[model samples]
Target: MSTIPTATRRRVLEALGVGTAALAGCASAPGAKEQATEAETTPQEPAMNAAQQTDVDRIAADPTAIPDPIDRSEPKTVSVEMTTKEQVAEIEPGVTYTYMTFGDQIPGPMIRVRRGDTVELTITNEEGNSMPHNIDLHAVRGPGGGAEASMVTPGQTKTFRFKATYPGAFIYHCAVPNLDMHISSGMFGMILVEPKEGLPEVDHEFYFGQHELYTTGDTGEKGHHDFDMEAMAAEEPTYVLMNGEKYAITPDRHGSPSMSVGDTARVYFVTGGPNLDSSFHPIGSVWDEVWQQGSIAGPPNKYVQTTPVKPGSCAIATLHAEVPGPIKLVDHALSRVARKGTMAIINREGAANPDVFEPEA
Candidate 1:
C-alpha cells in the first residue's frame, strides 16, 4: 500500500509544462500504436555485447564499485535516520504539496534487487538541516559504481553493501555535487537488479515518473511553496511535476481514476534523466506489451505507441482501461501539454461515485 510516501516516478518532461495530454479521454486501445519502428534497424534490439555494454557502461559510470580505480572504500556505517516531515501524497487528486521532500514525495523509492543480490541500505537524512546525502547504486559490481558506498554527512549516518551483478534498468542517483540539486530536491531511486528468476508478476503495478525542481518561485509556479537555496544553487527548477502534484497520478483518489474496466494497468515509466526527454503516451490505451528498456531479462516488445524515455530510462507498458472516461497519464511530450507536465485522471470503473473525468477547469 506504499503510496511511496516518498515519491519515485520521474518524467517531469517539459520540466515545467503540463502533462498527460491534458486529460486524454480514452476509447482506442483495441490495437495499433507501435512507433519505435526500430529507430534504425540494425540495432533492432541486439547490440549490447560491447563487453557487456562496456562492463555495464563502467558500472553505469561510477556508482561506486571502486576496488582500486585508485583505491577507495570507507563509507561502511549505514546509520541514516533523518527522514521525516511527510505530507504531499497524490500523483493526481486535489494535488496539495509542501515540497522540499525526502519522504514526502519527489522521486524516492523502489530499490529492489537480485541480479547478484547484495543490497544492504539504510538512509535517514531528516529534512534539509541534515542534508548531505548519498546513494549511487546503478546496479553495482565495482569501481565508483556504488558511489564509494553511499556517502552521507548531513547529521551523519552512512553505510555500504554491494554485489548486484547489473541485471538491467539501474539507477539510484545522488552523487551530490549539486547533483541536479539532490535529484530535484528529492534524491532518486530505481535499481531493479532482479535476474535470478524474477520479474513478471503483475495483476496491477504502479510507479510513475517525472520531476525536475528548483522552485523558490521565479514563476515556475509553486514547488511546494518555494524554498530557495539561491534558487537551489542556480539550478533553476521551477515546478515541473507528474507524480508529486497537479493531477499526480490520479486513478483512485476521486476526480475519476481507478482502472478496472478490464484491469491491466502496469505503467512504470521513469525518466527524470539529468533533465527531461520523455514522450510516453497512453492516450486511448495502446501498448499491449512493452518492457522496452527496463529489461531485467527482456521480451516484451509488441504493441507500441509513442515511447521514448531518455534521461535515465525505464518502461513497462500494458494498458486496458477498456474504454474508460479520461485514462490519460501523459508526457508524450506533445509541447509539454500544459506547463510543468502532468495528465492524470483515470476512472476505469467506480468507487467514490465515479462520474468519470471532469474535475472542472
Candidate 2:
C-alpha cells in the first residue's frame, strides 16, 4: 500500500468536490515528521477477518461503578489503567467508523477520583494498534495535563502520576500531535474529580460524550468509508453523535436505558469536540440544576435551558422528568441534528402530567 502525501491528499479530496472549508481549519499541514512517525508505528499483526466479527451494540456503564462521594478525612492513592485499541463499530445503520479508543469503547470509560487524591494513571496502547496515543486530562494541573508523559506507541505502556487538585467533570482525551483527527476518530472521555463533599444524589445518572465524525462520504452513507481530512479541517462533520452512534441512547435502539416519570436524571455530559462546540439541551425539559463546566466546587445554577459544552470540556445537568414522553437530547445548533446525527432519547415512563402539558384533540 502507498501513502499519499498531505498535499496530494488535499488536492485529490478537493478535486472530488469535497467541502470547500475542509483545508482552511487544519492547524497545519502534515509534514515528514508525522509521516515518519506513522511509518515507525505501523502494526505488524495480521488484520482481523471482518466477515467473522460481529458488532457489539452500545453498552452503558453502570452508574454504581462510579465511586460515591468521598470522605475527605482520608485521602488515599488511587490507581487507574486504561488501554488503547483500534476498533471498528457502527456509527449509524449500515455505516461504520474506525475508532481509536480507551478500553475499546467509544467515548472511552469514565475515570472517577476524589479531589486531593493522588492518582496513578497508566495508558497502554495495544500491540495490534498502528499508532502512538496519549492522554490529556483536564483535572490534572500539570504539564500537558500528563499528555507529554503518557505518549505510548503500539505494544507499549506509560505511567504518570497526578494529584487531583480540582473538583469538576473534566475531559480526558488523546493529545498526541494531530490529535484532532484522533479525537474525531473517537479517542475521548470524561474524568470526574469529585469534591470532598460529593455531589447531590439523584434518582438516576447517565454518562454521555458528544463528538463528530468526518467521513469520506455523506451522512447515512452505507458501507465503510475512510476518514475525511478535508471535512475535519472545515469542521463540517458528516455525523455528530452522542455515545458514539445514531440514537444510541433511545429506548428503541440497542436497549439503551430510559428514565421514568418523576425520576430525577443527572446527566454527566462531556463534549469531546476536536473542533466544534456543543450547545447541549434536553428538548421538552429544563435543567433543574446545572454545574457549569461540570464544576462540582461551585453551586449549581437553576433552570438552565442550554449550556455550552465547549471542545474538551464537560457539564453536569440535572433534569426532573415531569412529563411522560421521549425527551430528546440535542445540541441546539439544530443543523447538527437536522443534517448530521447528533441525538439521543430518554423515554419517560409512568403516568403523564397532562395538567402541565396535554395534547388536545
Candidate 3:
C-alpha cells in the first residue's frame, strides 16, 4: 500500500539485473509485491520486465565489422640504384674533408615509397677497397633484409628485392660483422615506407647521414688534421662528416664555403649511430616536417622547427639553401661537430665564395 522504501527497491532492482529467473511464476506471489517495491526504488532501469512481456521478440543484435587494409599476396616493390657517388663535406670553415659515400652522398640517397611497395635495389660497389658492402633495409620482411645473400663485392654489383610493410622512416645499413666499420666507412642510408594512411608531402627533401669512422687518428698537431694510429686505436674516429665530406655543414665565415638564399633545400637526415643518436639541427633553419618511428603514419609533423634525432631516424624538410653563405649542420652534440665533422659551400650566382651566411647575428 505505502510506496516501497527507496533503499529496498534499489536493492531488488540491482539483483534482478542478473537473471532472477528463479522467481519464475512466483513473481506474482504475496512476497512478489515486496520484491517489486524493492526494485522500484532502484537507480538502475528494470528492462527485465519489458523483455518478459515479449516472448516472441526476434533477437536483435549489432554486428561490428572492420575491413583489412592490406593484401599479403601483392606487396609493392621499392628499387634503389646503389652507385658510389663522390662528394665532400665541411668539418670546419675554410677547410674540406673528403670521404667515400654511397651514390656520392653519405647517408646515401633518400628512398621514398608509398604504402605496400616492393623495393628492388641495385647496389653497385666500386672504386673502394671495402669488400662485400651491402644494404640491409630495416623495412624489409625477408631474412637479413636479403643483405646476407646480396652484396656487391669490390668492383662488383648485385640486385635484391623486398616488400615494404609497416611504413616508417627506416634505416638501410650494412649488416656486416664489422658493421660499425662498414657504416663508419660511409655505407648507410634511409628508407621511407609511406603508410597506408598517407601523410603530407613537403617542398624539398635533403638527405644526409651522421656516422663516425674508426680511421687512424691524427697526432700531427692538436689543430692539424692528421691520422694518429694511437688515438684511432682508442676507438676515437679521427674525422666526422656529413654526406661524405668533412665540415660540409660548417659555414665559411672568412670567405670560404657558402650557400645561396633562394635555394629550397631539405636535408634527408639520418644517423648511422656508432651507438650514439644525433640531435642534428640547422643553426639557422627550422624543420618544416619530420618522419619519426621510422615514418609509419600520419601527416608529417609540420613546422617542427627543431626535432631530436635518435640513431637511425630521418626526416624531410625545407631549408633556405643557397642562402648567400654557409649553413652549419651540427650534431647538436655540438662538441663532436666542432671536434670532428665536415662542411661544404653552396655558391650562388657567381657570388665567388658566399662563405658563411650569418644573418645579422
> What is each predicted model's overall lDDT from 0 to 1?
0.51, 0.80, 0.54
- Which is the winner by TM-score between candidate 1 and candidate 2? 2
Relative to the true structure, candidate 2 has a C-alpha RMSD (angstroms) of 9.6
Q: How would the candidate models be sorted by lDDT, starting from the highest? A: 2, 3, 1
Model 1 TM-score (2 dp): 0.31
Candidate 3 per-residue C-alpha lDDT over 40-107 given as tens digits, one digit per residue, 9 for 90 to 100: 87766321211112211111000011112233434466466877532233323322233345665556
- Residues 56-149 of candidate 1: C-alpha lDDT, one tens digit per residue: 1000111111111112122222222224222333222222233334444445555554565556666555544445666665566655565565
Which residue pairs show collisions in model 2? none
What ranking emerges by TM-score with the best candidate at the front?
2, 3, 1
Error of 2 at 351 (Å): 1.5
Q: Candidate 1 or 3, higher lDDT?
A: 3
lDDT of 2 at 132: 97
Lowest summed lDDT over 10 consecutive residues: which window, candidate 1?
52-61
